[model samples]
Target: MKKLIRLFVFFLMFFIPASRVCAFSDGDSVIKIIYKRSYNNPPFPESTNNQYIIIDGNKSYCLFGEGVRGKDGKIGARVDLMKDFGNHTLYFMGPMIPEYTVNDYWSDSLPAMHWTIVNQFTTIKNNYCQKAVTNFRGREYTAFFALNIPIQDGPWKFCGLPGLIVKLGDSKGIYNFEMTSFEKVPNEYNLGIGKENGDYSLYKPLFKKWHLRRLEKDKARREADPNCLDCGEGVTVRYTFIENLLD
Candidate 1:
């Protein structure tokens, strides 16, 4: 009976199509994503440097955003994509560097999304495709995909679909993202949740009182300031909308 079961399993494994193998397990992998930003009101559309997102299983994701406008370091956010538990962005000053602290609670997620196919002939990486749409963060985006690669993962917090998200952007024609190429994992990559024996399972606490107050003050100041640089007085403000890969 044992021998029969083993033989049946072996036969099934050999019969599955090669394309089905693109459905990756929940293991670790390093992916490279090229990002670009644009502004409709100001009419400045340009491509910027690429970034990296390392999926460290269920605990963490390391996002390395680079380019003239991007932060130069990697931010180790949770798999949920919220709460700055590590030293990333302006939240951590020089004195706070090298120290790790978890935020009060995590509130972000790349939730399971519902996608309706728009078309199936949109070319991506020269492959036959299916274009679909989904909404996130108060915005709706049309994404082009190909079912040949069955993995639900893609750049940024984009996930949980029938195929790899090759490209996506808002419907009003604001921001856009697309896959450039694929490569071997970098040497600096790590598969562990914390990359080492450090922050995983144990994180220092961030004082909510001080942190929340600071965040509120910062928001108020930003709202008061008119961020438009050279625009005329008639224009209230010029907004630079960023398609946060971390979102």
Candidate 2:
């Protein structure tokens, strides 16, 4: 009977900690995401940018903004760091706009739109990492990763899953992103957005209108400056409308 009691105590000691670790690791650990510019084409004539997200349990951070041309001939997006926690979403951050605008960038534009992942799934590609494919706006995007950290979050308007997104790219390959480094976020990390609602659907129309309007403006600019080498003769604009995502 004493031996059985000792065995019971041993079992409790081993199983209790293991269970606790499994619970804590199950898609609910604080994660840090660091982003770095990877590649861009067309030099200054095109827009190229990357975005990333860091999820630390219920708290989250997003890094993105605009792309810049560095002195080393590398073009990449500007980094905008956003931190949020406790019942917050990505839309709470705010609009992401280019640092440089020609003129009247938002004159006839609608409010920027936001999106969030409604569903997602992941497959382990190898022993090191897994490939996560997410469905957002009726389209699928592929994200690759080398970490097994379980947390569901990504840069911009993307979330909903059981693991952290370390890298993501659009279906057509227009945008690509990855996390370069990470660390435990300090307690001072502020994760609040002042006077902003966290609804992604509210911003969809605004983004569409802005994209179309920007294309028009680019077309007019190119017409005015025929000799401009960066204009590419004209702008070739292509974007999937927010409305189409519903259908």
Question: Per-residue lDDT for 1-247 in model 2, tens only?
Answer: 9999967854554454344224433353434555543433333344544444445455554544423456665433322333333434333333435622221111111112233433343443321345656555554677654334544455554454344456677675545566665545333223333344324455456556666677788779888987788766354544543225223
Candidate 2 has an lDDT of 0.46
User: Residue 12, candidate 2: how far off, in angstroms?
Assistant: 17
TM-scores, all candidates, are 0.51, 0.49
CA RMSD per model (angstroms): 10.9, 10.4
- Write the residue-wise lDDT of candidate 1 on 1-247 in tens digits: 9999967854554344233332222243433334343334335545454534443323224344431222533333333232122332111111122242332222333443566777555667743457887876556888876555544555555666666567777787666666675432332333222222223112223323344455576557666775735333455433342332212
Scored against the true structure, residue 86 in model 2 reaches a CA lDDT of 45
What lDDT does model 1 reach? 0.45
Lowest summed lDDT window (length 10), candidate 1: 88-97
Which stretches of candidate 1 lie above 4 Å from their native place?
Answer: 1-47, 55-62, 66-105, 191-247
